[model samples]
Target: MPKFSRRRFRQAKTAPHRGFPPAAARSAAAFAALTLSACAVGPDFVPPPAPASAGYGKIGASTESAAAAGGASQRFAHGRDVPGEWWKLFHSKQISSLVAEAVANHPDIGAAEAALRQARETIEANSATFLPQATLGDSYTRQQVTTAQFGSLASSSSSSSSSTSSSSSSASTFVYGLHNANVSVSFSPDVFGKSWRTLESDTAAAEQKRFQLEATYLALTANVVTAAITDASYASQIKVTRDLIAAYRTQLDLLEKRFELGAVSQADVLSERAQLAQAQATLPPLEKARAQNRNLLMAYLGRFPNADKGEAVDLSGLRLPGELPVSLPSTLVRQRPDILASENQLHQASAEIGVATANMLPQFTLSATGGAQATNFTSLFSPQTMVYTLAAEASAKAFDAGSLFHTREAKVAAFEQAEAQYRSTVISAFQNVADSLQAVKHDAGTLRAQVAAEKAAAESLEIARAQYRAGSTTYSIVLNAEQTLLNARLARVRAQAARFADTAALLQSLGGGWWNRIDETPASQAKPTDIIATSPIAAAIRAQAEDARDGR
Candidate 1:
């Protein structure tokens, strides 16, 4: 009520202190001590040990090579590294170019890269908690106040010098502008390392996304190769079917002429025509399969279905790798993207336990608000208008019906789950390698058998056709011979393609040689240009448009 009381409060605020001001001195010393003593509450992560097994499986050696480019006998080069561009080992320029195109264009790769970037950005945001949060602010206002609001205090000061008592007591208003500017700061000291633990968890999560991006790259490239192989196989089948149709048509024509001359019966001509029809019937499905493969390639290259269906990769163009690379099982744990991803997940889960543990401890915060205010703009920063406040708060979880306890237990359980999943991933990786190793061995034997069978069937067909022409055998024998040869030829083509595909599978199972890559950029730092772009087909489509514009 007295001006003396307001003066006393301001005088106490500005009074000199002997040293650092007892309260502030104590808080600063305590903050330094806590900073020196604090440690992260959660356990630090250690990577899981490599697997115990030395090798995937026995690499069965074959003595005989099959009769074609993809039918060569393969040997295992154990402990040798895989190449980064493994597809190029096939020595086909088309395959290499197409795989490069798919890797550059695939949507899955872009999505993975974006996810990795987001995870990294979240880490950066969380890191801000370790530093003080400061804000600069300024404000202006127009204000009006009534003298009656101050009551007796306003009347005593102004009554004697100003006017009559009734006028002082009656409501009178004053209007003025108020100006304010301030810098405010708040900081929570990491007394027990909650922020550090959270950061560790986030860092591990970002690595998880990194490996996920690697997995996407690995899958996209491998799929492109496998799809190319399948396309080539389908193309071969279509060609074989077309040839069979032509031969059957010619045989039918020969038999019809013989029938007209009475050299062959009407039944013979009808049977030949039926065989020709059957051969023609097999053509559509093969063509459909080849077309579907083209559509799949279009998808891999990030093109529409109507986009330039690229030329089908020829099965005979692919040269089967003779010496297959087989990495040790111990190394596979580190090499495979899926296995590494699971390991990161396990690491993140471990960090989470520390975060949950830290949550149970006390948290401390210090905040200061300093500012100046004045009724007029010119005096806004004057000494008499300055003001400030200091505050300290400490909080701990006291009782929450055992909720924090269960939350920690849940985190521990999650860590164990991740550990189990990591082990499962390792097991699956080893199994894939073993299966691929065996496939490469056995596919050769299958190829050799089909080649022999095809040769014998061709010889039998020629004998049957000749004997029937000499009238010593019937058309049914020749028909059986032709069918057998057709089956043999188709089977041989498949067997040939399998060797190339299985070799690829083995390489993929060994982690696709990503570690040997020259560009070591992780997914988190990748630019948008690194993730997505138009496929080679885009250029082709543009060319087609230009051709149409020119009336070509």
Candidate 2:
């Protein structure tokens, strides 16, 4: 037989015997009933409206950030879509690699992924409530019975004869083995859509988990990038401080020679020595910060502090992104993970209201059992020994002291609470964007100012040193110039790093481009393991998790 025809034949042969009507007729009745009662109780969920504001901040705000060295003037292209791998915009291979590693190995990302999988599985388990449940079992029992128990004794009997009969009957007690087998099926129809409402709530919860997973991914990548930036900043600042110390030492030597030749006073030599000591003292703290940042980066990569495999990043290797994508306020709520997660919570709460409402209504269950019994195991399936039963049950709360009503009211309140939280999330998402935008703008101006100050200070120090060497100016003048120049260089390095970090912040605030991600699975049925190896990022994490599980 053809495959299609064979499947139809099998379905027909095993069709349920509902004992009331044909399966087709029962199905039609069920469909009609469902159509008539299709409306779910409680308020349907509607997404919160987007904010009315046009821009993240004041209207007509400048879109172009201030210009600084290294072409740090970033232009915000409104409505531009962000890429999934926003860190690549900095053009730093080391940072890109670190972020990739962090995404793959971070335990927090693994936890979030597991949570999303768990939620999906819960939804699957809950959905089974809509289907009929069946069970099968077999049993054998040995039992004994007495004829006297049935009152079969004659009334006109002598005591000795009756006692003799009773003794013989007790000695010959009837014992037999019985065998039984049965199949039972039960189903609770979703007449009021309670089961469906529960399923909906579970689906919404899974969606919330998916968004949380996305948020975790975003946070992990952002932290990795920021940590790399900080590490580079500290490295550059340490080098700058060390070089300034060397220059101070050289100036101290020149002062000592001049003091020996009576060309400068001993006080000048002591001042230069003190400045050199101050410059050297700055090294330990910067080194400490660098060490801390390295350890942090190692942690982000899911490794121990002593097991740092990450390469060092330098500020010179990073290029500031020229164009920045700024999502509109209207779209921010939809794109941000936290906002979307909150929306799912509101949806789950809405479904909970329906579930609670259904709980207050009547519930119906239909069940059927068929079996065979016999005194001997060989005759268990005989037609004469067959038995069957069919039943229907319904229950409703006639009076619950208003508990059901109050419970439903509580669900409504929870729904309202979720709605408020969703609104708050949207508002906070927009505020984050605003703060990042302002930081990017102001940090650019700060960098530009620092660059100018560093330049002027460098020129002043060079001129002062030349005058001191030519015996035309006091050593004090050169010492002050060197101190000013060192401070200026350190400030410049900070400003440069701030520009990069804030640019990353702006991208993160704009939702981290989750929409651009290619590895997203269907939220309802996907498991963390199903997609854990689907992308490079997830693959890395899965490999680490496996290694950890094996105690490698």
For model 1, how does the per-residue alpha-carbon lDDT over 356-451 read when each residue is reduced to its tens digit? 877888889999989999988789768999989899999987799999777877887788788888878888888898888888888888889999
Worst 10 residues of 2 by lDDT: 9-18
Whole-model lDDT per candidate: 0.74, 0.73
What ranges in model 2 sit over 4 Å off?
Answer: 1-37, 58-69, 152-172, 466-474, 520-552
- The residue pairs found clashing in candidate 1 are none
Tell me the spans in candidate 1 whose CA falls farther than 4 Å from its real position.
1-37, 61-64, 150-168, 172-176, 519-552
lDDT score, residue 471, model 1?
Answer: 83
lDDT by residue for model 2 over 184-242, one digit each (tens)? 99988877767656766776677788888888888888999999999989999999998
Task: Provide backbone clash counts, one per model.
Answer: 0, 1
Displacement of residue 159 (Cα, Å) in model 1 is: 18
lDDT value, candidate 1, whole model: 0.74
